[model samples]
Target: MEESDTTKYVIHAHISAEGVVERPDVVGAVFGQTEGLLGADLDLRELQKTGRIGRIEVNITSKYGKSSGNILIPSSLDKVETSILAAALETIDRVGPCISKISVTKIEDVRSSKRQQIIERAKHILTAMFDETVPESQELTEAVKSAVRVEEVTFIDNLPAGPDVLDSDAIIVVEGRADVLNLLRAGIKNAIAVEGTNVPQLVAELSKKKTVTVFTDSDRGGDLILKELLQVADVDYIARPPEGKSVEDLTQKEIIKALRSKVPVEQVVEVPQRRRNKQQMQQQEAARAEQNGKHEAQQREYQREYQRPERPERERGETPRRKSLRRMEERQERREPPKEQEQQPEARKPEPREAGEFAEIMKDLAGTLSAKLLDANKNVLQKVAVRDLANVLKETNGEVKSVVFDGVITQRMLDIAAEKNLEYLVGVKMGSIVKQPANVKVITTE
Candidate 1:
């Protein structure tokens, strides 16, 4: 046979995996090992460009026979052909739980033809390989007509530009011209239609070549399209709107939302089976019952323990106003001593202020301190200290905002702030210091 007329160039190899299928890692390894033999560059771009190396197809079968797929290589390159076959044979012997079946398929040698015919045939094979079902005459003719009518856009041909062309975060794979138009209307341009099960060789290459998300409709036809894609394409995400919804059926808003909510590839591959409402409710009840039992056990444990008496309140470490008043009383008492026996300064204390007024005072003080604020509820900043405020701001690189206090700020607050070198302390109310640590902004005002 003339080199151009040789029809025995395609080699077919079936590889069976030990479990569900060969791990992607193994598949990649096999590809890597045989890259020299197949005459393929094997990089994503080249794999996409050449579609098939020769007539050789590497078929993968799962141990359970539950899943299978194929990889193709062109056979025209003699060196690649020999290397591919040898590598396939070697891999069959060495890989885990995998057996390789090798064979060859004949194709009409159409070499020496015009460039356009060669391109057309190559494109046809890709679409055919990825398509789950070949359309009968009527559907086939219609698809061709639709594709022919498609308008071209920059970096795209025959598809409209409704999807923002610049967005590269996600990709959409669909079927046919009408579908592409619909997606465009929905303002989803990150999409490419297969134009039939015969996804163009270019589309097939792109699917494997890009970080893609597949979004087909919820019908058998759509399912077929997706199957074809999953079989031959490397997709990272899958998105589906409500059942009975097609990409064409979605409004622009719906399209954007659906694309944003694309499910991860693993989720798509292993869709969670739905449980009945009754079963779900039962599971919830069991969880609640377990929680209740734990709570009751905790309560019983608490009841078994004895509580300790609280210490007597002291004046020196009391509220600031109380501390000042107590000091004055102490002076008077010391001056009179035993003569003022009935006047125990502690017993003749001023009336206590309401919690609200105390909170207001702390808030005012916090405002004056001008520290970076953290989360505050009821005016108490969580995990913040006056001494650390300045440092925290500096560490955050000056993103700190004003700090406010609406709860009792204690001596511990001052200690922590000082330790951390934060600036500004604001409190809803102040307590008498065991000792006011030096050089910390401690403000307690309304």
Candidate 2:
């Protein structure tokens, strides 16, 4: 009992005696009856002396000359030893001259209960006691990817460029090293820099062999560089940042938008040259003003000469002056031709009629849960409910040039439309689309 603190298991039993018995009688019966029943090694007395077993506990109740109660015994012994000792106790049949019966019930392991408590506490500590500032796996992956891409800007022929420039069929030409780094961040690797307004020979040679797109800052310098590159290099296309936005500062979405909206070189050549025309117009206006000033002085002298008081018949014959005035008017008519209209800079072709027609079709189909497929000519070739859009588009040939619907354009539908090579997608709104095709146009009301 004094060594009970080392106990690993507790034994429980029910004791029933035919005759009334006290606690002392029950305890005595257990030891007296079980001693030497198995072997000397498992003797209850020896186990107690060795602190392998604790003192036995007996609770008794007396009613109608009968005793029935429970017994508890603590054991420091192993599993088999404890069970053998508990079973021997059941052999007790007499308690102070009365018939008795003991039934071994159950054994509870103390270590197991303690281990369960520990597990519960550990769960609470793990959740409530730790800092939660750790980022998600996806966020960490994105951060590392961005870092790697930004560091991958390499130099080719002393020009800052991405490593993929030589291998890719088409290359993007930017103004400076920063623009190349920014394009790398957007996962566009085939980019090289011009480094200044003067187009580099390396870029020009490469442009002649491979397709080039000159992307630059959204300012006068960018435009000037663009025009210079246009003359020196074989630019297949031209891409520009949005108004007042730098290419290096554009987000991935904006970068893709600019690149997708790139127009053919033919469509862009006259644009900058129009500014050249404006300069020429300014110079012509200055020359014309100088000539007009000279003409005004001459006119003042001619009027003074004509106003001189009555001259002789020889000086005024039919007014040698009136005929001379007629002749001067004839010379002026011959010198200056008809005043022509000043040429205005031609604007880029208006927005594709397909966009406006799509918008109108979208408005008409709104709230009707319907979709319209149009050919390149803005003629509706087929109309169907929105639910059947995917199946219909799949079954149709590549002749369907555009799609306008009354519902949101989800990623699934967008992919299907793109896979079918549809040119335009006009919807009431757009859903969370992860992949946007560059060739396909997406439009939403809001």
Candidate 3:
């Protein structure tokens, strides 16, 4: 056998034949034998038939030496022929060498194509099965995450009604689901709750649809929540009760009173300047006047007694006690009256200056008219007729931005008031047309 590095395996042979076997024919024989042994296809005929092939060399050893060494077989048949060949080689080496003996050694165990193809097919099937099932739900979960949208909105289940209650010309925002329920129980119908600090998208949209007011608790948590909301929300007002008070804790009457007495958020931030108590001051003045009146009456009586002439008594059996009493009075009259009594007013302190103080009186009106105009219930406000504005103005201590009327005002009326520069005429009912004043805004709310 010729040794070559390029071949995957080498088989060395000491053939007792006359000439070398064809290398191609030997290769083919090896292939055919392996095919039969390993249940595969192996073509080995090319090596065995070419008798003059130089690919394999036949070395004849005349010394008749016994050869022994370890040979490595091809990977495919390494395990299959190892034990059989090892035992055979051991048995052959022990025999005498003079008699000719056939010895076999395998250096390669090449495999055929058919077996490898079957293994590859099995791997492909396993890979395909894995690909089909693992990620089915994963894709759906990702799409669900991507497709849906959530928005923030103030939500409520109910509300209440009354003049003292806060009305919703602007939307009212509260704290939780339960607070909204409580407000509804108190008869405030146009209220919504924030539910939490997270302003939902729906609530945000509704706020834009109407003016918004944030009504929260008076504590730190409520303050924090309010701060977060105001940072992003378009709110028109804030209504906070006394610190530590919650809407849920307020009774219906407390709710009404708080609403009726609510101070604007802007005003809340300013220094407190509530007026001194007028009723108490007035009561004190009245008492002072009454005390002065009693003193004056006593002073007048003392003066009358002093001016009366002393009368001589006609002595009878009792020695005229009146004369003695008159003399005693004369002596008493020489003593001065108490200083307070001497200084007392002649009549009840003239009623406090009542005239030319209309402006001061108007300042004390209970509710501001202008604030009511701006802050009244949208439903009730929308129904206020123009004629009614005058009465509202008289009743309110606030200013009116514009007057809304039920019936029409004629061009004559506009002409009369043209010099005043009124900007608009708003009516809930139909109104007569006023022409030629192009700058005036006129709207009918019917």
TM-score for each predicted model, relative to the true structure = 0.26, 0.30, 0.24
Report the lDDT tens digits of candidate 3 across residue range 1-446: 44233223333333231223333333333333333442222212222233211243333333334322222222221222333332333222212222223245544422333357778987897667556566676787578977652222232323222222234566667777656666766766666766677766655665545666677776655767666665555555566654335777577887776666554433222111221233346778998999999789767766665556654434343233455556557867997875552331111121234222222322332122221133222222323322233334455433333333333344443443243444444432222232446544444332
Least accurate 10 contiguous residues by lDDT in model 2: 341-350
- lDDT (10s digit) by residue, model 2, range 115-217: 9999999989868976557767558758998867455679998999998999999999999988898888888999999999988899988986788888887
Comparing 1 and 2 on TM-score, the stronger one = 2
Tell me the RMSD of model 3 versus the true structure: 41.0
Name the top lDDT candidate: 2
TM-score-sorted candidate list, best first: 2, 1, 3
- Which RMSD values do the candidates have, in order? 28.6, 30.7, 41.0
Best by TM-score: 2
Instruction: Summarize candidate 1's per-residue lDDT along 1-446 as a digit string, tens digits.
Output: 12223332433344434345454634564555555654444332254345433333445555455445554444443333334454554444334444433333322223434466878988898677656565576687678988765344334665433344335655677665555676765545676777666555665566544677777775556667776776666667777666435676567788788778775543223222221233467789998999999778655644433232322433335544455455556755776434432421111111244334334445454423223363213333434433334345345432222244443345455565566554455454554246555545555443
Runs of candidate 3 exceeding 4 Å displacement: 1-169, 268-446
